[model samples]
Target: MNYWLVKSEPFKYSWDDFVNQGVGTWDGVRNYQARNNLTAMKLDDLVLFYHSNEGMEVVGIAKVVKEAYPDPTIEDPRWVVVDLTAVEKLPKAVTLKSIKSDERLQDVSLIRQSRLSVQQLKKEEFDVIISKAYEN
Candidate 1:
């Protein structure tokens, strides 16, 4: 299964909100690269639920419940979205600052292309981050 990371501000849609909701459609992605990433998503794919702007950390895990579809929240046809189901909350959030400072994570898209709201994660990077989440 492919691994991905998607970002949202905590105020707008926190990890708690996602878990409480159980499953929800992920939308409002405007960038072309981000849109492409959404389109590539498939059912059962794992996603990192990231809180951008404020804390800038990955707070939980989610699984894609549905593949890409035309975003319902917008009138424009350019954007797409996917349904995501909350999997589990990270014991400790992996901050973007911490990720960027780690040598092992140097090649992660989160640091290489910080502007991309949605991006693919390398398998090694995925394993590393998830392991970090469970760390003390």
Candidate 2:
């Protein structure tokens, strides 16, 4: 399954909010690249939920429950969204600082394209981040 990372501001939509809601419609993507990433998601693909802006950390895991569909929050035909259900919260959130410090994660999109709201991750990259989350 493909792995991905999606960002949300904690104040607007935190990990707790996602778990409480059960399933979340990952929408509001306007950027073409980010929109494409959303379109690429398939059913059961794993996703890392990151808290951008204030926290700047990967907080939880989610999986795609539904594939791309016209974003319900908007009337625009060009945009789409995927349904995601929270899988698990990380034992320890992986901070941007820690990721940047790790040699293995230097090439991750989170570092190269910090402003991108959604990103694709290689399996190795995804695994490294997951390992970091479980580290002491």
Candidate 3:
């Protein structure tokens, strides 16, 4: 399955919020690239839940429960959303600073396109990050 990293400001939608919601639609993406990433997601795909502004770390994992559909929260019909259910919390958070400093992740899209809210992650990169989270 494809892997991805999706960012949300902890203040707005914390990891706790997602966990408590049980399952929720990941929407409100206005950027073309980020919206496209949501559209491309398939059921059961794994996603890294990253807290963008505050923690700047990947705090949990989630699985796509439903495929993309038109976002209900969007005024524009072009945008889409995906349903994701919390899978598990990371044993330890993987911070952005540590990821950027790691040689193995230098070429990751996250580092290259830091401003992108939703971005694809290579399988190897996904595995590495999850492993590192446990190691930490």
lDDT of 1 at 109: 86
Best by TM-score: 2
- lDDT digits (tens) for residues 87-116 of candidate 3: 999999999998998999998877999889
Question: Candidate 2 residues 1-136, lDDT tens each?
Answer: 9999999999999999999999999989999999999999999999999999989999999999999999999999999999999999999999999999999999999999999999999999999999999998
lDDT of each: 0.91, 0.96, 0.92
Clashes of 3: 0
Steric clash pairs (candidate 1): none
* Alpha-carbon runs more than 4 Å astray in model 3: none
Q: Which candidate is the best by lDDT?
A: 2
Worst 10 residues of 1 by lDDT: 127-136
Q: Per-prediction TM-score, please?
A: 0.95, 0.98, 0.97
Backbone clash pairs in model 1 (N, Cα, C under 3 Å; residues 3+ apart or in different chains), count: 0
Error of 1 at 11 (Å): 0.7
Candidate 1 per-residue lDDT over residues 5-111, each given as its tens digit: 99998999999998888888898888999999999998999999899998999999899999999999999889898999998999999999888878899998899
